[model samples]
Structures are given as C-alpha cells and as structure tokens.
Target: MAEAVAAGRAASRGVPGRSASGRSRHARILAALVALSALVYAASSLLRLRAFQASTYDLVIFDQALRSYSRFGAPVAMVKGVHNGFGPDFSVLGDHFSPILAVLAPLYWLHDGPETLLVAQAVLFALAAVPVWRYAARRFGPVSAHLVAGAYALSWPIAEALAFDFHEVAFVPLLSALLVERYDAGRRVQAALAAAGLLMVKEDMGLLLVGFGFFLLARRGERRAGAAYAAAGIAATWASSRVLISLFGGDNDYYWAYGSLGDGMADAAVRVLTHPWILPGAVGSPPVKLLTMALLVVPLLLLPLRSPLALAALPLLAERMLADRFPNWWEPGYHYNAFIVAILVMAAVDGAYRLRGRRPPAALTRLRPVAALRRSRPVAALRRMRPWRALRRHLPAAALLAGAVVTVPFFAFGDLADPGLYRPDGRDRAAGAAVAAVPDGALVETANNLGPALSARTRVLLWDREPRGAPWVVADIGRHTFPFTTLEEQRHRVARLINEGYRPVFRQAGYIVLTRESAAPR
Candidate 1:
C-alpha cells in the first residue's frame, strides 16, 4: 500500500504544474457534485410534496413553527398530536428547543404550505455536499475525490432522509460537514459558529459536540478551544433538558424514550452510571452491537474506523445503540443517521488520508477554492511523522470489504418503488382543497396524514384525539390516514359529527368537510 501511495505521490510530484492541474480538477468535481446534489434533492422533495408522500408528523412541526416565527407568534404546532405526540397549541420550542428554525421563518410570509419546509430541507441537506466534497478532495487526489463525493451525496441513509420529510435533522448534515471543514481549516470562529448551529438543531447534538471537542483536544492540540467546546456543549445539554425543555415542555423532557432504564433523564443517568458492570448490557450484547456497527460502517466501507476523528461519532452511536425506541434507533437508513452520517464521512476521509501520514499541502491553499485553509501546520507536522504500516497491512481487507457492497441489490436501496410515493392524484387534491376551505387560524380537526397541509393554521386536533373544542373538521372518509386506525373507523367518526351540530360545508371525492351549525359559513 505504501509503495502504491509512494508511486502515486511521485507521479503527481514529477510533472510540471501538476499541482495546479490537480487543484483545478478538484474544483470542478466539487462544483459539479454540489450542484447535482442540490438539484436532485430539491426536485425530488418537491415531487414528493406534489404527490401525497409528505406526512404530517414532521412536516407539520417544522411548518407550524416557521409560521409562528413569520407571523410573530409563539412557536405553536397547530397540528400537534396529529401524527405524533404533543399537546394541542404546544410550542415547538418546548419539544426540542430548536431555536434555529427561526432563521428560516420569514420565508413562510412569502409562501405558506408544507412545500416550503420540503424545499428548505432539501436545500439544506444538499448543501452538505459542498463541505463533504471539499474534505474528500483534500483527503484523496482529484480523481479519487469524485468517487468519495459521489458516495457521500448518494448514500442510502442520506437519500432515505431526504425522501422521508422535513426534519431538524436535515440541518444536521450541513452543520456537521461545516464543523469538520472549518475545524480542519483552523478557522476557529467559523468552526465555533458551526458547532453552535448544530446544537440549535436538536438537544442531543450537544452531547455529540462534547465528544467532538474531546477529539479536538486529545488529537489536534487545541486545548483551550477544546475545553471551551466541551464546557459549552455540556452546559447546553444540561440546559436543554433541565432548564429550557423542562420549563417549556414539562418534566417529561423526552425521557420517556428511555423508559426501560428509569423514569426520566435524571433517573436514567443515575441508573446507568451506578451500575458500571451494566455497561456491556446497555449496548444489547456483543453480537447485536457488532451487527449495528456493520449496518452503519459497511455502507461507508469502514473508513471511519481508521481515524481518531471517529471518536466524534461515539457519543451519538452510544445514544442510539442503548435506546429501545421501536427498533428505529438501530436502523441505518432513517432520520437518526442524519446526526452522524456527515461526521462519519468526514472522519472516513481523514482516516483514509492519514493512512499515508499526509495532509493537504500548503501549495493547495493557494487555490481559490481552498484559500480558506491558510494554515498548514497539520501538513508540516505530518511530513515529519513516520509511515503507518499498520494501516497499510489492512488495505487488502478494507478493499475486499468495500467490494462486497457493490454486489448488494437495488432492493436494498434507500427509497421505495411505489408509484404512489412519487405522484399526485385525486385524493391528494381533495385533501388540499378541504384544508384550503378552512380559514386561516381556524380551529379544525383532521386525519394524521392531512394535518401537515393545515399546519399553518393555529388550531388542529389529530384523528386519535377527541375533537372536543374543534370548530371545524375535515376527513378523508374513504381512505385510511397513517399512524391511526382504519378508514371505516374514520368514516364512522365523521358520521358522529352530526350529533355535535357540525353541518357539511363541502362533500366530494370521498372527502367531507364540516363546521358547527352555530358557526360561520364556508
């Protein structure tokens, strides 16, 4: 492996003006991937929106929160409990304290719908390719950099996340990629801001930041900065659960997820720590953990394992592995992976590059694209470091393991082949019309899947919840709404609206809209 790297190194060095040519090639690859990734994700998400694939659970949370911000109201989820759990009229901040959503809130004033959230999510996720491409370019040559960028952008986990719905997690990849880029570039202020942006995406990200800070301190020699990062992350995590979310969301504070361990966050922590011997058991036995590792790392070729930067992902991995939440915590192609995917990819690039004990040469910094990296201490130091023969010895194993992934079936691909997932039809149009008939800020009850369409309103009750105070209700009587019971049950429930003085405002296409008799007309 060293001989191969040495030969490749010599070829690039022997040619006149080769370095400049290589930097130009890297620039083109980065530019192409960034553009292609953004376009595909944005177009696909928009198509999903036009179809009926987008759901209420997450899309509504993001849209309603943004609506509140745009309208200068408190961040209330109009569609809370429709597809997931939360109190009606609940502030989204109370749930996750993601103040960062406020940054894009103004867009709702110009356009109001779930599509806005979808577009924003797509853009954010695709923008992650920018940093990933740059990092890969620095790690590998301009030629191999293309392959890394392709994998980073087209990873099943990332595609699955984009196809699912709008999540604060969509922001995770962008922020994480930026974190690694700025940190490696030695742009302290930019890196710190990137880290801060990550915590604003979700409370759990604070713990991951603590791990990141530890890696920087232990591996990169940035003592003071690392200490500050660790302290900030620890404080933010404590505040997110204990102070911010607790004061806003109540004592539950999302600790219900760890019900098997204890009652709440405090109890769970105490239980885990006090029983030191239970650490092994916490990960659900050795074999299961090994399987989980393969699921995560195999797709990426296990490149993350070759670097100390892998430690940045440890806290998040531990968090997911120890959870008993619907087998979702262990899944590879889901929203949970959004938190660690970008970090792992960046780590993988570093790992692969470190195999030869080389870093981006200072000459590469002369290029406009990498001019941000003005410092070259990493390269200077690595030039003096000894060869990593251990990594060389394992190259064959890594190559063989990476080769197996090529044989996996397209069925193992991230997205489904269902036509309904990508096309709009009568039911979708009917649902939208029903939601549109209701006035803005009107109190309405709706099906689980349809809730996000009306999420811009200030009042909405989920299908499972009793429609006690709702002044208006919309139901797709002929169809089944997800995360709820049968269509027959929904039709029966809608039939009962007559006893509550609700008169039909509009009825067509298996959709029925109703309002209380004593209320205003449609």
Candidate 2:
C-alpha cells in the first residue's frame, strides 16, 4: 500500500514542469482546503444542534443508537422505536443495515454526544478529498487536482447531508471514492476492501457494488472479480433485508416504497419489463426526480454522462427515482444524493481525461468516439487557437470550482454566514433550561427538536399524540415542532399530560418540563 501511494505521488510529480517541491506546495494547499471544509461542515452541524434547529427524528435516533453501541449494548434507538411503536427493544439494524456505525463507538468513549457523530461525519466527508485529489492529480496535474477536490469538498450533496444531520451515508462518499480511485489505480485488493466496507454501511449499498461489478465485467482480465462482487452483493442485500433486519425485529416491507410499481423488488422488476412504457411515467411523475437527476451531473458540467464509470451511480439513482412512495427518496435533498457524489465526480474526472484526447483506460477503451471527437475539425481548430490551447487543460477544473462557488450561498454551508446561526437566542436558552430540569436516568418524553438535547442523559421517548406515561416530559410548545402539525395540537397534548398526574416544573419561552406525581425515575 505504501509503495503504491509513493508511486502515485511520483507519477503526479512527473507531470510536465512540476518539481517535487512545487507538488508538495500544491498538496499543502489542497490539504488546507480539506481542513477548512471539515471545519465548516462540523461547525454548521454543531451550530444547528446548539441553536435548537436540529430534530430528534434522526439526529436523536442515531445518537441514541451510537450511545448504546458505545456502552456495548444492542444498537437500540428508543427515540425511533417508541415513536414508530416498535418498542424499546428495537435495534436500528432492523430499520437499516448500518452495522458499520459500530466502528465509531470508541469515539463515544471520549465524548458521548451527538456532536461526536457530526464531527466524525465532517472528517469522513473531508477525507474523501484525498482519494479524489490522488485520482485527478494522476491525470490532470496538481493544479486541476486541487480544484477538483475543492469542488467535491463543497458540493451541494455533501452540504445537504451535513445540514440534515449525521447518518450512515456519511461513510458512503469516502468509501465510494476509495473504491473508484483504487480500482482505477489497479489496486484491486484495496478497492474490494472499500466495496466490502460499503456493504456494512447500508443494505441497499449492495446496489452500488453491483453497478461496480458491471463496470469491472466490461474490463478485460476483471471478469472473475466482477462476477464474485456481483454475486456477493446480491447475497448480502437479500440476507440483510430478508433475514437480518427481520431477526432484529423490523419488517422488511416497511420501506418497500414502490407499491405503486408493484408489491416488491421482484414484482416491480417484472412489472417494468412487461410494461416498458410505464417506465417514463414512473420515473418522471413528480418532475422533481428529473431535476434531481440533472443536478447530480450538472455541477460537473455533465461530463460524467460520457464515462462508463458513471454506471455505478445509476442503480442507486434508479432505486430512488423509480420509488413513488417516498418523496425524500427522489428529492434533491438529504443524504440520498451523498451516495452518488463521489461516483459522479470521479466519472467526470475520467470523462475530462477522455475529452483531452487521452485514450480511455482499461474498460473505458471501448469509448473510441471520445478520442475521435477530440481529433475532429472543430476540436482541432479550437485547439490550434492560442487561448483554447492555453486554457483547455484547466477548463474542467475551473468550471467545477466555479459551480461550487456559485451554489454555496444556496446550500447548508451558506448558513455559516447567517448571524442567527451563531446567536442562540431566548428559545435556545429556554430549551437548555428545560432539558436540564429533567433528572438524569429518568424516562422522559420530549418534543422532536428537544430529543437530542436530552438524549445523552435521559432515556428519551417522543412526546407525541399518545401518551407513553413517561416520568418526565419536556416540550417546546412556543412553535409547532415536528410530528405535530400545529401549536394548538402541541398545547392540547401538553394539557392532556397535565390532566394525567403531571405538573409543569419549568415553564418559560414556550418550553415546558413536566414531572409525574406518582412516577419513579424508571
């Protein structure tokens, strides 16, 4: 591994006119950009949590699960299970196969809080830049490599994921980039290891591996590995969804969000084949799905469309777009798109190389038209122009970096510039006091936004329409919060808690903390 890395560095330095010292300087600059991105990512998420803008639905659920893992317990997320009526014994694995989250358990030993997960996610997102830089630097020289890495670091997909909250998908970008870079570098062992890691991130990640298998099968001397990967991916997805999730007390059909197409995967596949015309309507019904598909490739100037490596992103995209049940699945937001960011960016890099008259590498050798186009009269005439000749090498990188800069103000990272983000006002202060009013080790039901604030110290449950009879309840009734539609509804629910042997011990800023008269800590 060390030898391979050294050789890759040497190859980067071999780019015309780049001395080892100059290459080192460029590496330093890219490293600094990555570090800055990490800082921004972590700060945005942490600030969102501190400002009381984060929700319990996922942040708290993941925090509770991570807390359980840190304590060497089953990854039971009471916040998620109780809210879903799945009971306290429910393991998150039953909901989504992300056992790889257990690897971060040790970090909880240092600081067992939701912030730990956010920071770790930021680091992982930024670390993906290393592989991205290596891959681009190998082909486009150090300057373009740095720009590509910067574009990836600040991409909208990653910014959206960071804005939403921590998720297992945080592992997707790093592992996906590694899989692409290592495979392209012909380090099959390392690439396979990365692919294996992705399988542990999510059950559906097998689709990515399957797509990569298709890419490998098309390459000479790679059919054996491709066949093995494809088989393993199929088996893993089947076992995890059909057996493991059920073993952990979850229903597989719970997330089968394609009922409009058919009953399940097989039925949907059969339906799509039998009625091919239905495909267009199924994928484009909402129109937003098409926008999302376009956004995924547009930032890279649609260059990924020219590379077969982009095939790896298709299955996951298809999985989301074809599902009519969940809007979030097809929406242009959240961690869903994070899964494909690295794949598309790397594919764009390959496409850029092919556009530069470089023969397609390995399996991509079949794309001879790309080279032919480079030699055509129009392209040749453009190349003969002094300006085009001078600027052509940097065009892709410059366009990518410019795209990121143009879009930054519209994404989560833009929140960094908002003074309100850094200023936690009265609501935040009241939330802090209300969370603190609840005693440690107590069973408490809390509002969706308050769940993470209290999760670290309390056995937190969702304070929803139905009362769970928790010993303590904390709610922010000043405004409508998640799982509740209106302030009137939230107030009514709190009033019912008061009717059921509970008294408000702390009330300020629309925040209320209640303790049951006869209830014990447990």
Candidate 3:
C-alpha cells in the first residue's frame, strides 16, 4: 500500500493532475478578468452617454464625414474637399485614421448616430485593459500584474482620453499586445504586418513601432529580426504619409499650417524631450497634476533597470509629446501619450517585481521531506505534504488586491457626472431633431456655427454654389470671424442666401434654416 501511494505521488508530479488543475485555475482567473473588463466597459459607456452633450468642432467633422460616407461610400481619403467652409478643408485622413474608422464603420452601421459611436468608443477603450492585463500577468507575477493593469485602466490620461473622443489613443493596448506577441514568436513578417496595421491607424504609431523594434534589437540581440521590424516600420510609415498626401494634395484648402516639414520635424523632436516636464500642467488642476505626476513617476522609476522594455516606451512617449506641441502646448485635446504612459507603468511594475526576486514560495521546500517519506511510506507522506494547500493560501490575497484596485476607481469617479452643458444634450438634441425633420435630398446651408446641427440633416452649400438639387438650405446665424467668432459674418451669409432667393423656413435660438423658393423672381 505504501509503495502504491508513493507511485501515486510521483504520478501527480509527473504531469496530468498538476498541469490540468493549474490550467483550470488559470482559466478561472482569466474569466474573472473578463468579467471585470465588462463592468469597466459598461461604466465607461454610461459616462460617455452623459458627457457627449455639447457640440464640439470635431463632432461636426465626424458628422460631416459620416454623412458623406453614407451618401458617397467614399473612404476618408477621398472626402478631403468637402469642408464646411470654416478654416481648413476637413479630411477624413486627418481625423479618422484607417484603423479607427475600420472599427467605427461597423458601429456606424449599427447605430447611425454620433452618440452611439461615442458609446462604442468608450467601450472599446475600456476593453483595452484586457490585453494590458494579460501582458502584465505574463511578465510579472499575479500581484504586480494586477497593480499594473489597474493603474493603466484608472490612469488620469486614459480617463481624459475617454472623455474626449480622440481615437488615436485607443490603439495603445492593441499595439502593446502586438509588440509582445511578435517578440515572443520571433516572426519578422508577422511583426511587420502588425507594424503596418498600426501605421495606417495613426502616423504616430510608427514611433511606437520604432521604439519597440529598437528595444528588441538592443536587449535581445535579435539583430536580424529587429532589422526587419525596423525596415517594415519605416516602409509602413512612408506608405501612410503617401496615402494621406495623395488623398488631400489636390485640395489647396487642405494645407496644414502647423509648420513646414523640416520645422515640424524639428518641433516633433523637441516635444518628445520636454514631455515628462509638461506632465504636471497637462492635468490642469494642481491637485490632480501632483497626483498624476506621482502616479506616472512612481511606475517609471520602478521599470526594470536597463531592460529593453523600459527603453521601448521612451520613443513613443516622446513622439506623442512632440506632436502635441505643433497645435498647442500640453492641451488635453492632444493627449495621445496615454497609451505610452500605460505601457511605461506596466514596465515599471514588471521591473519592480523582477528587481525584488523571482522565486517560488518556500513551502515547496517541504517537498524534500515529503519525497523522502514517500520512498518509505507513501500514505504517511501524502498526509504530511499538501502542495495545493500552500498554493491556495497565496491566491486569495492576490485576487483581493486586484479586485480592490479595479473596483476603487469605479466607485470613486466612474459615474456619469455633468461635464457642463456643452455635450450632446439640449442644443444637440434640438439640432438632430430639426435636421431629421428636413426632407431627404435637401440642400442645407447654415451659419458656420450651426454646421454641427445642420450637418445632421444634409450637406451645406455656400451661396455662390447652386443647391445641387437639394430641397432644403439651412443657414447658420451664429457668427464668423478669425475662428468664426462674429455674429455679423453669420448675418452676412444669411443675407446672401436671402438675396439668392432662399427663404427662411425655420428659426431657433442662434440658428436659422432656409429653403429654395419654388419660383425665382424675374
């Protein structure tokens, strides 16, 4: 009986029982992670619903793009010339990076409303935490992995990015996961394909690919694979830029005034160098700034010392910071660095765990005595040793920590709060309703200010251009100045429409709708 028991103990260690049970445990943990991810997504969706009240300029661009896509079936690149006549001709290439539009196209078909798109975006951003968590867990132990994931999901930059509808930032988790997978597989072609996909998503994604590739070469000494990755990354970057130029080159109004190519390149370099310094100001309020700074810095300091992963995040972070300088200095609108920030935090946590020690628990030491007893009296040894029992003791604390980190942020600030009335509320609702009331195939002209509202129904036409068989001409009565700031310019545009035989059909606060007369006066 003793010998039989000893054989059973050895058999358990050989594979079947231990390996199968471990896999089952892992699956259960992953399921719990998925459930947590779903909850976070739901919370983000609710917040987005409440926040998308005010009509922003970007919304107008997206609305127009969607309307044009609905009408023309053209990709974003082909729709460069259809500006609302404000400042620059809006290009889909400028806003809807290919990957983002790819995701949004399906949502557009499902809901066909900007509000629905916003909700979908929030959910996508929230679900990004899953890949991040998995990556962290694979690199670090469960304790540190949960901490890294929690920090990323609840980070202030991510929160702000979600609040604003910047799709560029949403690609971070996907990019991180792709890099990790490519590194592990040692497949240059797959890595290149992933890099290409990211480049098409956003021009800045090239920087991430470069940084990641460089880190792989520098640390792993996988020079051949790294060279291929870098080469592919550069090629992909060039291709995306060429595509954008080809799409928008013919339109004189599509010029980017940020800077010349050389100057822009130089400015981009400077922005990356100054990014960490600007973190304090980007959060706006001092308290939030300090807290944010602490969170960012702490993880960075913890990044595994001199590891390639630590260095890989630098270029991407720098590039995002540099890009932010061209349009504005440290503004929330350009908070694309949130992706790199989360990655940096993960690296820091991974570094911290590695620095401390990578060792299994000491209860495994009891296995020696148990093995000795097993050779003599296997039944007694089984009673004396319980490896599963020791493992179970540590699992609860790790799970509890993960749960607390994920849950605390949700309870504290996850609810939909009023971000003031500028979202998709009263005015947006009224505008959408008014646009829906208009008949299809209507030519709409609005004061520049009402473009977001007017865009909801049909495309706008300037007075110089004849209505392209459109039945309704909705005119904006707000204002037009340097940045469409004066009401008089709006009045002038309105007067021009009236002179052109378009009659006012509907008037609301700060807006007026005009339709073409059935009979033109001779």
Candidate 4:
C-alpha cells in the first residue's frame, strides 16, 4: 500500500500538473493575442481618423462647449441668449450634465479645441476593447474573446458615433463591459452598481440596464436582487424626468405631446408596433437586415439548449427592439445597437464551436485505411492526439482571424452621408479674418458663425447686448431667432448695427463681423 501511494505521488508529479512552461507559453499566446487586438484597433482608429471629417453640427456644438469652458468655465446653454440650454430635454435626464464634456475637461486643459477632444474620444473608444475582450474571454474562452474584442473595436456604428461628439453613445461599450463583468461574477451588488453607473453615463443606458436586470432576475431566480434593480430603475427614470423638466424650465419641446407617463407609454407602444418594418430600415441594407435578424433569432434558438450566453445576449436584443423611438433609422449615430449585435454574434459562434463534434476533420478519412493498419499498434494513438493538440494550439488564432474577416469590412466601407447643417463657404474664413482685424478687446457684434470664433479673441456681443469688455451676447432677433434671420431681417439687423456705430470689417458666406465705430465710445 505504501509503495502504491508513493507511485501515485510520483505519477502526479510526472504528469506535468499545470506546468510553468505551459503557463509561460499560454501567457505568451495571450500577450500575442492582445498585441494583435491592439494592432487591429490602431488600424481601425487610423481608418476612422481618415474617414472622419468634422461635421458642422459637431463643430457648432463643440465650439459652444469650448467657448463656454474657456470663458465661463461652463458650457454655454445657447449660442446667443435665445433658447440656450444644456442637455437633451427630450429624453429623460438626457441633458443634466454633458458626460463627455466633463471627461474631456483634461483634454481641453491640454489643448483647448474640438480637434483635441475628438482625438481623446477616439482613444477612449480604443481602450474599451480591453474590457470587452475580458468579458468575452471569461465566458467563451480566449479565442472568442479576441474575436469579440476585434469585432467591437472595428464596428461601423462605433466608428460613426464619433461624428457627433455625443456623450450618451459612448456609454454603450463601457456599460456593456460592466454588465458582462458583474454578470460573470454573480454579484448582485456589483451588478447594481454597474447598472447605476450605466444609467449615470447616459439615459439610454437605463433601457439596457432594465433589460439586463430582468434577464438576470429571470435567469438566476434572485427575486430580492431583481426587485431592488426594478425599484432603482424606476427611481432613476423618475428622477431623470424631474431633473430634465426643471432644467428645461418646464419646456416640453423635448418630450412628446403626451401629457403624462401613461400617454408617453402609449405613444412609445404605437411607435414600435406600427413601425415593425423599422427594424430592417434601422439596419439600412439587405445584408445588414439579414445579419441583424440572424443575430437576434440565432442566439434565441440556442437559448433552450445553452442558457448563460443566451441570457447575456437577450438583453441586448431586447434593448434594440424596444427602444425604437429614435429620430432616424439610418442615422449612423443610432447604430449603438452594433455593440449588442457584435456580442450576440460572438456568443452564437462560441455556441456553435462548443456544440461541434469532437472528431477529426473528414479529410482525414482518406487516411483511415492506413490508420486502420496503424491502429493495430501505438501509431493510431499518436494520430488521435495530434488533432486535439492542433486544435488546442490554433483555435484562438483561427477564431480571431475569422472574426476580423467578417466584421472589419463594415468599418472599412460603411457609408457616411452628409447631414447638410453647415456651410464650407467663405463664412468661417471671413469670420476669422474679421476677428483678426478687430482691435484687441474691441466690442463686436457678429453672427453665429462669427461669435464663437471671436469669443476667444475679443468681447463679442451675440444678440446686440451693450458691450462690456469682451462680453459675448447672442443677438436676439425678435422671437428668439438669431442667424436664421430672413433676408429682410438680415438686412435690417445689418442696417441697425451700422446705425449703432458698428462697421463691417469682414464678411463671410453667412456672417458679417462688425466692430464698434470709432465715433462711438462706451
């Protein structure tokens, strides 16, 4: 008995239990995978940079924030004093704080401009791949992990979302990572915290959180935890609504005309139910249409047989289907659902591989005759081990390559249409020239195009306010309109400025810059 025990110990030690050499090799493989992921992300980032042209809307919004940050240490509510507000009032709690702006504060401090902030956003987006990979790896093995990360990093929707400098959209990946992490750990508290953080990151994330919460509660049978989540979600929704209403000064412009929550619910239901075809429209093409449908239905078909991953994917699918009230179907910014789609695809691929038969490729059957002869001895044993070893060593690399091939094309060739809100005309150039010609600290009144540009250089009156040193006023052209001035109004405003001792020193496509006339002193 003692000899047998000694033999067992010796066998255990000789069996190479989790060898350091093997571990070192695994670490190297993981490192290579991570490095490859970074390379792909870097390539995607470079591509995005090339593809991205600063849109007029982004410039207008970013310039407003930058000007506010530079002058008042806060984002200006309006360009000119009329209807100046912060935050999206239409969505619950949509406009309380500009999350991206707050995060970009450091970047602003480094080099205060929209270009700097855009770069910062791109960098944050790239970094999101790490957590995404971790989430995939934990559930589906390192192979699926690398694939999911690469797919997410290069996704078209994420690339397009960068155009708007939108704060709400960035939360998709961040919140997804947190949800995946907490769900994997089976920690209710951490999950709740993640949910709350997601909601705080953006109001739309609340829909994601609610869907995920119900999914978790249903799957895990955690009644108390689920109840807590439901309660918190309700409270957050209410609080966000109240805060938004107050911020917008009871203006219901952002909200639908439904007078109450019940009416809003009815409206939301009508929007979704009546517009079933919006799903295909949202995806924008037949291929994407097919892909989107496959993504939703495929995993669900697998749910009865495989629960964990399907559970994770269900919330994402539900969020996309339920939140259909967005303004445009093809609007690239609304493509936040791509993150969900990517995750679900990865889950489906993982399930497929997991369900695959544990057998050698059929091509090996040609060698079956030789193997039959070899099976009379030890040679067949070696042949059986070879396939397993090959699979173990190369699976992750193969999966990564396959995922890249499937998903990279979307980002590489996605359509970007112009939204025609800004002009490339000589207006900006003229405005810049006018500001440059103005005397330092000159009191100036300029159009919208000129105001933000001049705000940094001099005290510009936006809406015909009395010039205090460097005071910028958004000119109130009656009924709270500024640059949307009719031809008649534009002529009147220009004439009035001239009569008030302002001289046009520079003219651009859409704006005229005027400095206080030398004849008039403060």
Minimum summed lDDT over a 10-residue window in model 2 is located at 1-10
Query: What is the C-alpha local distance difference test score of each model?
Result: 0.68, 0.85, 0.49, 0.47
Model 1 CA lDDT for position 58: 69
Task: Rank candidates by TM-score, best first.
Answer: 2, 1, 3, 4
lDDT of 1 at 202: 80
Summarize candidate 4's per-residue lDDT along 20-127 as a digit string, tens digits: 564344334444444443444334333333332332233435545554655535554333233233322221223443344555555556765444545544544554
Model 2 earns a TM-score of 0.90
- Per-residue CA lDDT of model 3 for 67-181, tens digit only, reads 4465545433211233333223445665434544555655566655555545555554554444455555555434344445555556555655555443545666655655554
Record all residue pairs in model 1 with backbone atoms less than 3 Å apart, i.e. clashing. Answer: none
Would you estimate the TM-scores of all the predictions? 0.78, 0.90, 0.63, 0.59
lDDT of 2 by residue, 1-522 (tens): 233234335435544678778866775676676777778788889899998777787898899999899999999998788788798878999999999999999999999889999999998898788788878878887878888998998899999999888999999998999998888787889998999999999989998988888777877888998888778888888888888888889998888988878998799889888998888888997999999998888878888998888888888888899887878898877889999998889889988888886644755544678767767899889878998876878888888888878878987778889999888888888999999998898899888888888778788888888888888989778999888889999999988888878999999999999998477532
lDDT of 1 by residue, 1-522 (tens): 232233223223322334766755555545656666667777777776666566766676677778878888887775653334455567887778788888888878778877787777766776676666556655554455455656666665667777677888878888988888777766778888999898888877888788787787876467787788788888988888678886665454454556667777678889888976666675764355557567567666676888777888888888777766656666654577777878877777777766654555867867875774344667555545666443444443345234333523331232434566565577777877877888888767776666766665546566553555477777777777754477777777777877768888878788788888355422
Worst 10 residues of 3 by lDDT: 7-16
Question: Lowest summed lDDT over 10 consecutive residues: which window, candidate 4?
Answer: 7-16
